[model samples]
Target: MTVESPAAAHARGAAVIGPIHAPKASEIFADLLRQKILDGEFPEGQPLPSERSLGEQSRLSRAAVREAIGILKQQGLIVSKPGRNGGSIVTRPTSQELVASLQTYVRSQGWGADNRTLLEMREIIEPWCAAFAASHRTDEDLQRIRQRLDQASASIDRVEEYVSAGLSWHAAVADAGHNVLLSAFMSAASTPFLSAADHGRYDSLKARKSTLKTHKAITAAISDRDPQRAFDLMARHVQGSEAPLLENLATTLENDTAATG
Candidate 1:
């Protein structure tokens, strides 16, 4: 038998190890760029470096750099438009985006929290959101909230319109809370919660009237800048609105109201 050469043996051994690709170069580059964007190295509305520059820094092919940039755009970190004036531009992270993300996350959790549990969680934080709104809201916030409330009040007979107005009012109150985290939470929760409460028809006629009354009371409390009253009104309004859905809880609330009365 012929003896194999040392070089031949080494070559055969290297072939056995395959191509040695750990991960995609584009993925690594994207990760590095993501950190930079999150770290504010690329501020909102600022243009990102050209693909050529990124390619050189990353020691990657132009195609790989493009892939990385595409990942950033997908993440909503950067936007790219084709044209003379368009390239990769960093995005301003909005509360709306945060809320949308939160909504997606909650949905993904599936059984993590049922509607009742989710509503309860909302109830815990929302009263405080109203109280804060009372002390912190600006004239702009007041105007926005009042406009939506007016629309809701006027649309009592119209289901879709009423739902739309109710959503707007919830969003306005969330904005009025003046806390980014709380605003985002409420914004995310508003659609699902109200949609569930309405059960497809938006709101029952009786429910709509009660909702209008309760909302107006809460708005008045906030407008008057009465934090304690705002909190109380909001709590009462939530308990009342959630009653039909959670019959036993509503019954308990009614019993308490009667006992107190």
Candidate 2:
């Protein structure tokens, strides 16, 4: 029988005693790099170590290091340049990208309560966004908002059209805020609520008329560049609209429970 070297014996021991299901080397390296970036160990615009160096440091192959860098690039945490200074550089994460990823993740989780919570959170944030938009809106932005409002008003008889227009109007307000992050976040969060609002039993002519009036008032406040008025009107509009829907949902849920019981 041949005696194995100490290093070989240690390797055999590690194979038995180490993690039963360790992550792939590339994934492990990617996670380590991602944590380093988040921890500010790698500042924005700073180039990452060369693949060879990273491989040496991590005891991984060059291919594993490259794969890890590719993963980081996809996450918007780094970018690659192709030149003498060409390497992966740390980058600031864009809010749009972050929100998009988050939206996808939430949808994948198949959670209904998350959508409701998102709507509640938007109710808290979007009024401020509307107020900012009103304060800072240019003539062009106001004109665009007016066009959407007019379209919505004209389509009040058609539920689908009306719902589409309503969403557009809210989106216009968010766009007028001139903050991409705020706009993206509001747009994503409001999607399910907007769908729920559309399908609820609020499509009556009377409800349409009331909604139009409230929308008009809010638009007028925005057009007038009255931040306070716009904020107040938007807050009232959301609360007023949400109350009836919440009551209807609660009643429906109670009835369902009673019937089952």
Candidate 3:
């Protein structure tokens, strides 16, 4: 029996997988530009070449160049300017952009409706964030955390206001942790919880008071630079909050199903 050549074997496998489509010129150009920007070849705040210039250098049409530029703009890698001497400017992506993109993706995936998942995420992240803040926090950070805690305490009786302040207090802790990615993720993950609160899914004097009490304790731990205490307090706080949050979510989901049924 004749042995199959490597080329023939590869061709057979390719046939099973079907043909690969070539990327669009715009996509290829956008990828190249993105790499250059990220690699610091094109420094932030520097103007990219004119569309006509880019078209000439890349051997792409003007429309393709424009499309590539638009792609970069959408990805938060660049900003476009109008008028004379105006073109795309290179820029680094910010946490706010990450927050927006993450929020969009989470919403699109129909996440955040399940309280259990959110609680799980919080349990993993917030405790560490609190612990980190204990070591990394500045006086300014402590001040901000204290202010947010006060706001949360004052607003405890009002569901919407309390939720807003409560979220802010959480955000302050994340920020004080000095971890940019975690802070952005926390900000994005908060949207659904805020929505739940807006609907008045769970509101009670007891729960609010409990939250404030735990928040104050966590804040004190961080302020005192006690990472272990901060971690423990935050973990306990998240764990304690879970039952009420989940119960309310379940009730809301049932009522929605009943109404829609």
Candidate 4:
């Protein structure tokens, strides 16, 4: 073979040495695309670039571009269709999807203690919601609250039924605040606490009666449009009942740890 020029030799040597060991182009592309979706640069229902075009634009192989699209699909950020003009399309993230992801992450990390912390947060935030409901409630709102209270009072003979009704009453108060975002947040935050409370000593006769008394007081304050009184009653109701419930949970956990260890 004829001797190669210096530039040709350098090219041969570089080829033998293999391509530069840079980061995976697919990962970089994926990250860039993900950011675009999150920032609303690629809005929901908008079709993404074709795989071949995206590959050329990003200076990556078609395989890299396709892999990035796969990642976005898995993340609930995009959906893919296969046909003529088929491509990935961005989708709006749903609250249920986000909540499921969060619950999975929290459960994987053994976040029971964090659930307790959320209960503490509810004690503060929910009272404010109740106060807001009290101040802003219309006659129609009062009627709804009264209806829930009536259902709860009727179920007082059965602890489980009563507790379920009681939780509904609080949920109604949150809804009556006329703030959908706050209502959604409180609903998510209280889910774990309500489950725990359902199985706790709050199921006892004396506890049921005490809870009914507190609920009545809170309802009365809300009905009378007494925001300060509603706030105070809610605060005391949470502190008095939640502290004992938590103490019960702590004792149970200690016993469980001792047995398991």
Candidate 5:
């Protein structure tokens, strides 16, 4: 009537268990270093030990130590400096790096070719971001948004400049929302949106003017601290803008299918 322990039952071939795989030495070492960096034990701008020293301390070979460092470097946890005074230094990832990583991830997921999906994501996040900006934005945030808005207005006839300014304005709004992740995501999404717009249909003067009008209205709503107005304006603005882009994408896809077939 006695029940056997799981470990003992497994050992006696009476229990089935998944295979146990040990992590590589490099991964273990990398995890240790990553934890230290994140925990502030290894503060930013401080150089890590030399490869030989790290190898000695970790009881790993030079290759294994290098592999660990490489993993950390790739993860944006540390930077490698060359020269006599140079080595790996603990560092946090920059905003630009985060955007780059997010862009890579988006592309990997096949989201680049289909901008409707990206627009759908923006539709979900941006209205709330505008609402938050309406409630939370500071004078400096207002000024930044105005600056980009003015730039967009001035560059309405210039496709590249207009798109760039428009994206910057959206990013400013996201930043004003006081949400770091949303701001980063807005920045990351900009490049792909730009790529899609570069095909020329989105740069029509009429469309630019309409977009500018909506942006100005959205700005006004945020300036007046009207979250509902800001939210509605942004929602409509995004939906209005998404239509032409989606239509263009559909046309392009159909043309491609016809050509391929």
Candidate 6:
């Protein structure tokens, strides 16, 4: 008796496989809608086709169309409202929620979203954000940024107020770049760190002054439309901010431990 490997048998035309069956109508319809939505045919906050119309167009039962819509909803592609003047509307998913989801996934994989990771992310992203804003920003964008800066400067000596203003300043820079996803990522990468530093670390006048100086420098670079300077200043600023933040975290933890002990 002779035996041959499956690969050899297939090459000798002794084995064959049939084509895969077509996907169900519900899936196919879902895919079509998904593609169009992803392609921006369905702009955010706009209504999708009515259920009756969709079913008619797809030539599928209402049940199948409903299933297809359910799939899209699960993927966060659409928001549905059922009432007078309410329907399924395309959604503009923000980076905050998306980044949060990804962070959760990272945690599930055993990577903690810690201070070190947050600082590293800022080191990587803040410079790029500053540079992009320098290149892409308009006069109106500059005005928006200046307003945040003014707000921060006015409350520089106030702890919580300063923190809120400073966060707004960073958000302005992110928005000036006109990249929504990057804006969201900057928020995600910095929020925990800023919250910790603001509440526990930045009590010193020196730290506040240093932060204000660096912020001014970064803003000046962007105002001058100097991308390279913007990048360099932001990199320097984020790096400089890390040490104080770590100290702040340590002090807060030590205080808690002492109280408990």
The models' CA-based lDDT, in order, is 0.79, 0.80, 0.87, 0.76, 0.87, 0.80
Question: After superposition on all CA atoms, what RMSD does each candidate show versus the true structure?
Answer: 10.3, 8.4, 8.8, 10.8, 9.5, 11.0
Candidate 3 clashing pairs, residues 3+ apart or interchain: none
> Across residues 175-205, which tens digit of lDDT does each residue of candidate 6 receive?
8998988887766554554545555446787
Question: Considering summed lDDT, which 10 consecutive residues are worst modelled in model 1?
Answer: 194-203
Cα shift from native, residue 83, model 5 (Å): 6.7
TM-score, one value per model: 0.69, 0.69, 0.81, 0.64, 0.73, 0.63
lDDT of candidate 5 over 1-261, digit per residue (tens): 996677888888885665699999999999999999999999999999999999999889999999999999999998988898999999999887888898888767766524767877787889999999999999999999999999999998888888889989999999999987888888877777776666554557987898899899999999999999999899888776346445667998999999999
**After superposing candidate 3, which stretches have Cα over 4 Å from the reference?**
1-19, 113-116, 198-202, 241-261
Best model number under TM-score: 3
Alpha-carbon runs more than 4 Å astray in model 5: 1-23, 81-86, 107-114, 198-204, 241-261
Q: Cα deviation of 120 in candidate 2 (Å)? A: 1.2
Error of 1 at 253 (Å): 22
In angstroms, the error of model 5 at 1 is 42
> Which scores greater on TM-score, model 2 or model 4?
2
lDDT of 1 by residue, 177-240 (tens): 8999988887667656555544543446987887788889889988999999989888776665
Candidate 4 C-alpha lDDT tens digits along 1-261: 995566786876743333477777787889999999889899988899888889888888988899888877778889987788667989965656665665565456554423666657667677887898899888888788788888888987776677667777887888778876667666565455455655665767787778788888888888888999999888777766446445767999999999999
Error of 5 at 30 (Å): 0.8
- Residues 52-129 of candidate 2 have per-residue lDDT tens digits of 999889989999899989898889998988999888889977877877876776666564423556656666767887
Residue-level error in angstroms, candidate 3, position 99: 1.8
Provide the lDDT at 114 for model 1: 35
Model 4 weakest lDDT span, ten residues long? 105-114
The candidate, 4 or 5, that scores higher on TM-score is 5
Prediction 3 global C-alpha lDDT = 0.87
